[model samples]
Target: MGPDQALYVVATPIGNLADMVPRAVEVLQCADLVAAEDTRHSQRLFSHFDIDTPLVAYHDHSDDQRTARIIERLEAGETVALISDAGTPLISDPGYRLVREARNRGIRVVPVPGACAFVAALSAAGLPSDRFTFEGFLPAKSGARARTLEQLAGEERTMVFYEAPHRVADTLDAMAEAFGEHREAVIARELTKAFETFHMAPLAELAAWVRADSNQQRGEIVLMVRGAERKAGATLDDESQRVMKLLMAELPPKRAAAVAAEITGVNKKVLYNWGLEQK
Candidate 1:
């Protein structure tokens, strides 16, 4: 029997076309239809590889009708390939709705991975990668953006974000404000492309560099910020302290410390001592 027809989510090169994997090429070549975030932008890659598969536009703004059409095609035993303008689809790009709809319709979804900008940047950003968060894009407005950063102020995991050239400086400034000027950060620009640059510095320095150098502000950018450092001898966070205080009101200090330790993963002794200080 022929291979089961499926929806292939292909990862295209972020910048350098050479990063496209052989399997991704094969999938796209064999796809009965290719759903691209931008038909014109993907056309260059298709032409470069000489793959003549029919292209359809499917992106963030695509309506339900468009997604329904793709699902209908997938249900009809035709293999469809989904691709973003660059990197994997649905990574701050479109295609989530289409993929979800296709799955609901019992269409098999296959991933043909290749290059991802954030992954590429994190791998080289010299930041702790054991645990991380991909916060795609921050709010464009200053107040909203600051509030968002404030919410993540205590995030201990490495943070990765995609930012537009125009807002890089402002985002960096807000990050410095929320995460602190001394927080280490890496700004990766035009990754995998000619003139690619990765600048590593403290948040304050990075913000200053971006503000001073207009060239650094222009490009496809990935901003990686080091996680919040746990202060020595002060392992319990503010939230844990608050929890401990609330527990102290209901229980004995020792019992409250023990409960807070269990709940917050903080050391019992630390919570006990902190509880004493609060009283």
Candidate 2:
């Protein structure tokens, strides 16, 4: 409302410099101060836009003492802008404490939306976007990643995850194992850059491709894994699981799914994968 009463949470471009919105740039340029998750990284973005506003470091690693300082600035009627290194602040990055503190201190929190990699990837993932969940990034360790995947194994909504270049292949392999090798998925990398690529395929195929081509291992990666296809059967009894096996062994996937669908009233495509996963 008033000129000096708000803290703006601004979204910056993920990669492509041109993706920056004019209004976001203007806000950052005019803000009293910018509380950046990484002053050095944010400086690059600020320099790109020629924004000379002073930046104060505020990140997850920073303690409450730092938060107190930022809160003091806000309380003093400074219009601070919070920005992460890339994309939106607080998505998988820092900003929660500052936002909460600002609100608690009666400071207005304004969100100036712009480019977000997860949303951009989801729009083009070709998977069902109507019902989806953003998991940010999975744990790096094998057991942890597997446990994470296991918890989501039965989830029926599409899921998105961010993975570093070096870990994308390993994550994909883990996804294939936990979610089933044939689970449909897509990988979007170097998004909005000249080398931007989107690969849509079965999890197994993507994993294999990544292993075979070293080039696929580079760039910031956004993975979209199709949710577990719900099985429709009268409930998989000994008889049905046996029938599922025989049908999958004897008929093509399409025909098998159709037969399974008829037998259990579950969606054909979903039952088809359930049958395959059974194998």
* Best-fitting candidate, scored by TM-score: 1
On a 0 to 100 scale, what is the lDDT of residue 80 in model 1? Answer: 95
lDDT of 2 by residue, 69-138 (tens): 8788878877888999889999999999889888887789999999899999999989999999999989
lDDT of 2: 0.85
Expressed as tens digits, the lDDT of each residue in 14-68 for candidate 1 is 9999998988888888889999988999999999998899999998898999998
Candidate 2 stretches with Cα past 4 Å from truth are: 1-4, 233-279
Q: Give per-residue lDDT, candidate 2, residue 2.
A: 28
Q: Give the runs in model 1 whose Cα sits over 4 Å from its true position.
A: 1-3, 232-279
TM-score of each: 0.83, 0.82
